[model samples]
Target: MDATSFILPLAEITIAGAIINASVHFVPVGGAPAAMATSTGVGTGTTQLAAGAGFTGLLAAATMASQAGVSLANPVHMLLIMLSGAVGAMIMLGLTMLIGQIIYVYGIGIVPAADKCEKDPITGDIQKPYITPGTTGHGIPTVCFVSGSIGAALGGLGGALAYIALQQLGFAAAIAGVLAVGFFFMNAVLASYNIGGTIEGFHDPKFKKMPNGVIASFVSSLIAGAVLIGMAMGL
Candidate 1:
C-alpha cells in the first residue's frame, strides 16, 4: 500500500532468490554419469533436485502457516514456518539419498566413493580405493549426503521466505504460493546452468563458481520483485 510495505516485500524476494541460487550450488548432481554409476551425486540435473526439495519445503511451510494461532506477523510464528520448511526439505532429500545409496550398494554391487577428492571430506574414508577402475565414483558418499541435506534445508528456507514475503504483501495464500514457486524455479534454473551439468556438492571444484550464479539470481530476482510489486499495486 505504502512505500514501506512495497520495499520490504521486494527486498525479501530479492534475497530469497539469491539464497535459492546458493542453495542449489550446494547440492550434488551427477547427471547422466551418476545414473550409470560413473559419477558421484544423485542421478539428475541440479534444477530438478533443487526444485523437488524446494517445493516440498514450500508446501510444508504453507501448511504450518495455515495452522491456527500461527500468524506470519509474529516473528516466532514465522520462524516456526521456516523451520517446518527446512525439515521437510531435509527429509525429502535424505530419503532420496538413502534409497539411492541402497540401490547403488546392494543392487549394483559397488562401494560408495567420491570422485572429486582423495578421501571423504566428512568421514575421512579413502575414496580412491573404493571407486571402480572405469568409473568416477558410485553412490551417495558421506560428503555428498551431508552437502545435499544442507542444500535442501537452505532451499526450503528460501522458498518459505519468498512465500512469507508475498503473503505479507496482502496476497491470498494461493496466489502467494504460486508466485513463490515460480520465483524459486527462476533462481534454481540459473544456478543449474552456472553448474554446467554436474557437481559433487561443496567438495567439487565447481562450487567455486557460486558467485556467478548468485549474481545472476540477484539481478533476475530484482526484476521479478519489481514486477510483483507492480502487480501488488493493481491488487
Candidate 2:
C-alpha cells in the first residue's frame, strides 16, 4: 500500500466518524421521562438507538458486499452497498418508533406531541394543546419520526463506509465488521455525551450542539485511523 491507500482510508474513517456523530443528533431520545409518557421520542438513550440501527445497517451492507459479483472497487457497487445499509437502518428504526408509538397512543392513552415546538413542522398540528401539563410531551411526533428515519439512514451509510474502508485495506470480513462496530460505538458515544441527556430529534435546541460532537468524533477518528493503518500493516 502506498500514500493514496493510506490517505484515502484515513479520510474515509474520519469522515465516517463525523457523519455518524451528526446522525445521532437527529435521533429523538427522551430517556426516563419518555418511558413514563412524560416526554417525547422513544424511551431510550441516543447511543442505544443509534447503535441498534447502525448495527443493522452494517450487517445489511456487509451482506450485500459479500455477494459474488459485488465489487467494492466499483463505484456503483459501493453505492448499492451503502444504500442497503441505509435502508436496513431505516427499517429497523421505523419499526421501533412505530411499535413505541402504538404503545404510547393506545396503552398510555396520550397524544403524540412535541414540547420543543409550538406546531408540528411536517403536519402543521398544534403541539401545545395536546401536551399534558407538567410533561415535556408524549410519544413520538411526525417530525421526530421523520428525523429519526433520516438519522438511521445516515448512521447506516457511515457504518458501511467505515467497513468498506477497512475491507479496502485488506482486513478480512469478520475483522472489518468488528472494527466497524467499535468505531461506530466510539463516535456514537461522543455524540451522546455532547447531547448530555434527552433530545427531541433535529427540531430540539440540543441539536445545535452537533458541531461540537462532530469535531470530537473527527479528531478521535483521525487517531483511530492511524492506529488502524498500523494494524493493517501488521496484517
Candidate 3:
C-alpha cells in the first residue's frame, strides 16, 4: 500500500535482474586460447551458455515482476505475484529454446573465425563466450545452441522459486540453510561429474560448480515453499 512497502521488493528484484544479466548473456566471445588438451585437437566448451541460464532466468523474472509492479514481501503478496513472473520467464525461456532449436536444425554451427578468450587468472574460471578447439575453429554446434535455451527455461523455474521463497523465511536464514545443504550436494555432484567424465573420457568435469546450482535452487524453492506455508497459516 505504502510506497516504501511497494518499492523494496521491486528494488530487490531490480538488483537481482542486474545479477542475472551478468551471469547470463554476457559470455566471452568465441575464439582461440580456448583450446582443450583433449584428443580432439582444438575445441571449445559451451558451458557458459549452460551455466548462465539460471542467471538469465533470474533477470527475466525480476524484470517482469518489477515492471509489472509485482512485489513479494509477504506470503499473500508473494503468492499472488509468483504466477505472473513465472509465466513471463517461462515464455521468455521458451522463445530462446525455439530460436536455438531453429539454429541447430537449419545450420551446422556458429564459428568464430578469429581468436579471443577470457578467463579468471586466479580461479581459472572462464569469463567469455566459449570457444573450444574443436568447436572453436570448426565453430559451435547446433546441439550446443539449443541447449542454451534449455538452460534458460530451467533458470526461470529456479529463479521464480528462489525469490518467492525469500519473501517468507527471511533472506539470510534461507541462504544459510541452503548453503549448508549445497556444500554437500556440490561435492556429490562434483564426484559424479568426475566419474562420469572419466568414464566418458572427457574433461567436461564440474563437481565444484554444479553444487552452486543446487544451492540456488534449494534456497529459491525453500523460500517459495515457506511463503506457501505462511499463506496457509494465515488462512
lDDT tens digits by residue: candidate 3, 90-128? 565445444533443355344322122243232444523
Candidates sorted by lDDT, best first: 2, 1, 3
* Model 2 global lDDT (CA atoms, 0 to 1): 0.95
Query: Which is superior by lDDT, 1 or 2?
Result: 2
Q: Estimate each model's TM-score.
A: 0.98, 0.98, 0.35
In model 2, what lDDT does residue 221 have? 95
Best by lDDT: 2
Per-residue CA lDDT of model 2 for 1-235, tens digit only, reads 8767789889999999999999999998899899999999999988999999999999999999999999989999999999999999999999999999999999999999999999999999999999999999989999999999999999999999999999988899999999999999999999999999999988999999999999999999999999999999994
Runs with alpha carbons beyond 4 Å of true place in candidate 3: 1-51, 68-137, 172-235
TM-score of 2: 0.98
- Models ranked on TM-score: 2, 1, 3
Clashing pairs in 2: none
lDDT of each: 0.92, 0.95, 0.36
lDDT of 1 by residue, 1-235 (tens): 7878788889989999999999999998888888888889889888999999999999999999999999988999989999999999889988988998898889888888999999899989999988899888879999999999999999999999999999988889999999999999999999999999899899999999999999999999999998888888894
